[model samples]
Target chain A: MSIELEIQLVAVVVSVACSLAGVFLVLRRMALMSDAISHTVLLGIVLVFFITRDIASPFLVLGAAAMGVATVGLVEALVRTRLVREDASIGLVFPALFSIAVILITRYAGSVHLDTDAVLLGEIAFAPFRRLEVGGVDLGPRSLWVMGGVLLLNITFIALLYKELKLSTFDPGLAAALGFAPGLLHYAFMTLVSITAVGAFDAVGSILVVALMITPPATAYLLSDSLPRVLILSAVIAALAALVGFWTAWLVDASIAGCMASAAGVLFLLAFLLAPERGVIAVARRRSRQRWEFARLMLAIHLLHHEGAPDAANESRETHLGEHLRWEPKFARRVVSEAADEDLLVRLQDGRLELTETGRDSARKAMLV
Target chain B: MNPLRDLLFDYTLRTVALGAGTLGIVAGALGTYAVLRRQSLLGDAISHAALPGIVLAFILTGMKSTLVLVLGAALAGWLGTLVVMMIVRHSRLPEDSALGIVLSVFFGAGLVLLTYVQKLPDASQAGLDSFLFGQAATMLERDVVVIAVLGAIALLAVVVFWKEFKILSFDPEFGASLGMPMRSIDILLTTFLVIAIVIGLQTVGVVLMSAMVIAPAAAARQWTNSLSVMVLLSALFGAMAGVTGALISSTAQHVPTGPTIVLCATVLVLISMAFAPERGLIWAAVQRRQQRRQIRADAVLGDLYALAGHHESEHAHDVTVLEAMRAGRTDVHRALDILEERGLARRDGTGGWTITRAGRAEAEQAGESGPDGQHEREGSA
Candidate 1:
């Protein structure tokens, strides 16, 4: 296969992997923590590079994953102390570690090719150049293999402990009483997040990694209420975004990572506007329609309550009902016309409107619902 | 130090220090309200969302004056927050997701605008990149004055409405019931937050400026329980972080000021989290240990009293220290030693021991205590 196809394929796999974990992270309100871990991983990378001068050493990923765990640990420690709120803890930990990394890189500038810009935003276009070989057989891109391994580990871990994870996330106190060890589960979850973040760093960089990890799951959340459905939907949405974003970047000649992030943003906006039941526009439209129908029902009920029982004489008064309802004449007429079309009302000879037997019962049922 | 000291005396360092200090104080004060309202992330979001506004301001006005840029930034930041609130109120999505959505969308638009601006044929746009990470090294006297004046205004507004802000933050529903305009007060608070953020953006940039608003308040919270004390200490801590960050960056030839300041703020937060009294990690650990020791001691004393009252006919008068220790079991030996040390037990002639006045009182108290023991006296009958 050509190098470009290999790179694109790796991108798709890694995006799905991250999005799968992103579903839980976003649901658990740990999206910013994911962002913090991705950025703070630079400290681990720089520290590892300082010790072992090889940038391609697999130890770099391990070191970065360790740093990511440390980032979560530090944030948790700070927040539990009550010295810092959660957002404040996040703000404190990542920047400090990132700056330390920058300072280390600047101080050791001569021996290292590491730069802050590159660390912050990686070169995904050049990812395919770094190949992995096993037993003298070329194994395509190394990032793809690393991410694929991590993804496999994540799937196995999450699947095996799905019930435990679900219970712990939804109710930690109850899980703890049931001997589930919430602290163990929390650390386990954070470790998985760190590993996934480190794996995706080469393909998407920090900002896009955060954006993809958060936006897809967040959007999926709007589309579904079930955890399994959210996970599946998030992965599907992320894979689609990765494909569309890559093509958009190719066509527009823009930064691929930036374009990918922008695409994720667009997906979120689309979900916000179009998702059924919970989408902004859908909810607004539903509310207005409910209000309109309620108004029509109220008018019908008022006429029925006031008019002399749906007898022959009251049916004559129903046709001249526009002046009594006190609504705009046109609007009242439109309401009556629509109600009659639904057989909830009948228009009399003198232009008044009378409620049918069906209309009275329907109005009562609507009030109860 | 020769050339560096000379440069430090120049107008640039002075202006930068002034700007950083003003921004720190203003952001620190308003941040208390932000943190209390659970909108700590709002400052971070607004700072990022202001990027497009800055670029748009420059695009429209074709000027790089500090006032115009700040005004434009404030407008964008407020608009971003307003959009976030609107999305939350109009949809079923949670507040954090709505914030994340607005933050990413605004920042993405800013990036596009920035790229376009960079391509324009304007040489004055050369330093726009510096604004993203901040370039305090290039700050002027006028910029410092602007920050100082705005900082004073924000401070005065907070002072005049301190009671209202306190009521609104603690219980907005009650405040509304008491005839307070909760919405207007919230708007006033948000306006101050935006101004504070806008000014700090020039000194600390978008990413780190949010840190300035949050870290100091967070640190100060560990040291004080009162809201007024928290706010005051937060402002002081913020100023210290700013000054120290400036001093460190200035002392080091290659260090960037914004990250250095942020690093200083992070250090303060760490120190408070680990060492502050009452709320710090170390303090909580010590408290837990002390409570365990007290429980052990109380258990030993209670056992001694139970043994003493076990029989009235056999050795009804007193018991030997050895017998008391042995009867209480192996776990009570260390606790007996502690009780003796605290003068809660006394040894009589012929190796007999008896409960001292304090020991009897402690035994009675332990008997009256409940399961959780810490609040036994007040909560128990």
Candidate 2:
């Protein structure tokens, strides 16, 4: 495969792995936890790197995973103190940890190749050069293999614990009572996410990790109701975004990660506006339809109630709706005309409105219900 | 030494410190509102989102002036915030995910622009990425002046719209009922935050700037419950952190000023949480310890008082029922020792204890203090 194709594969694999975790994260209202973990995991890598002085020793993954769990635990501890709110706690912890890592890099190991910019901004174009070797046999890009393994791990984990994770995410109290240990499951999942983030960090950068993880899953959430569909849909969306982002990067001669993130944003915006049930336009249309239906019924009910009253003539006048219902003059006129058009109500020669039999029956039913 | 003179005497050091301090004050004052309003992470989103604006501004104007960059940043940050609000209002996606989306995507876009600009022939984008982790050491005198003027404007707006902003923060529904333009008021308040964020982008950089906003107000929150005092103390802490971080990074080798400022502000947060008189964790823990002991002592004393009513049962150890009250507790002996130490009970040579007149009086007072214990237990949860 060409370098471009390999780069696209890495982006797709990384995003798929991230979105799998992202699905659960979004449902748990802990999406920002991924954000916090991704940044803070750098501390673990930095700390472990100082001891080993080898960037590729594989200890860095352990370090990153540990710090991710540590970030969750520390944030929870601070929240337990009730001294700081959750957002403030996350805001406080990540930067403090990330800053320490940055300082360590700038101060103690300035000459090393552990560049902060690459970690955040990502360099997927260069992935083809970092080939994996097994017994001197040539393999493909290292990032592709690493991310593919992480993706496989994610799928297996999700498959094995689907029932438990779904139960815990939707209703934790029930999961806990059922002996699933939601808190323990949460920490375990976060730990895996940390490991995945460290693996993907080389391919997509930290912030883009968040973008791929959050935006795709969030868009899928809008497009589906069932959990299984949501997961599958998010993975597909992630793959599509990766492809589009890679192509855009090639077209613009820009950062691939950025292009991918921008693609995710554009896709989510489309979902936000055009989804079947939950999109803005759909909701707005539903709301307007409901308003008109209610207004028509209300007009019939008003006329029926005053049909035989002593002030019936005054109450049935077209002006009464604007006065009593407090609707705008234009809206009242439209509702009046629509009711007439539908034969729900008739306008008398004197400009009094009267409900027909069908209208009266419908109004009575609405009142009964 | 006069601190002001010493601080302002050096051109480079003074510019860096003043610039950071100004950013701190604006962010600190505005951040108090952000924290109180539970929009703390909005600062993070705005700061990160401002990068594209910075790069875009430099690209559009072909100038590297702080004002132009700040203007670009403010507009971009404002747009990012509006998008977040739009996403939350229009869709079921919660605010955090919306924040994450805008923050990352905008930063990604900014990096794309930054990379594009670097490839250009002008070379004016040389210092553009400095807004990433910040280069406080290279902050110019002109940047300081720009920051001060903007900081003054934000602070002034905070004062001018204090009442409306306060109502908007605490109870927007109530303000709207009273016919205040809550949405416009909210926009104004957030706009100030955006300005503060853009100003600080040149000092703390995009990644660590959120800490500058949160740490100060959070620290001050521990010190006071009053909004005015919290805002004031927050600004003070922010300024102090800014100056201190800038100074340390300048004096030391290999310390980045932005994170140093953040770490310094974090230390203040830690101190406030641990030691602040009203809400500090240590103080609460100590009070809880003392309260528990008081409740325990009261219970044991009341036990002695009630047990005293039984005939000739003045000696605690002699009473088998009191031993039954022990119920696997070595603390019973400890409580007895404490009572004896205070002369509330006397130890007989036969290894028994008797309640004194003082113990009886205190037990009567404890029984009278009904519901005090109830309130204390309720407060603990």
- Reproduced native contacts, each prediction: 0.32, 0.82
Candidate 1's C-alpha runs over 4 A off are: A1-11, A82-84, A128-145, A148-185, A226-229, A307-331, A364-369, B2-10, B59-62, B121-123, B179-184, B282-381
Please give the DockQ score of every candidate, comma-separated.
0.37, 0.75
Q: Clashes per prediction?
A: 7, 0
Tens-place lDDT per residue, model 2, B26-110, is: 8899999999898889999999999999999999999999999999999999999999999989988889988988998898888
Please give the lDDT score at residue B281 for candidate 2: 91
Question: Residues A35-98, candidate 1, lDDT per residue (tens digit)?
Answer: 6888788789888988888988989989999999999998888677655678767777787887
Q: Which 10 consecutive residues of model 1 chain B have the lowest summed lDDT? A: B313-322
Q: What residue pairs are clashing in model 2?
A: none
**CAPRI-style quality class for the chain A–B interface of candidate 1:** acceptable
The Cα error of candidate 1 at residue A66, in Å, is 1.7
TM-score of chain A of 2: 0.94
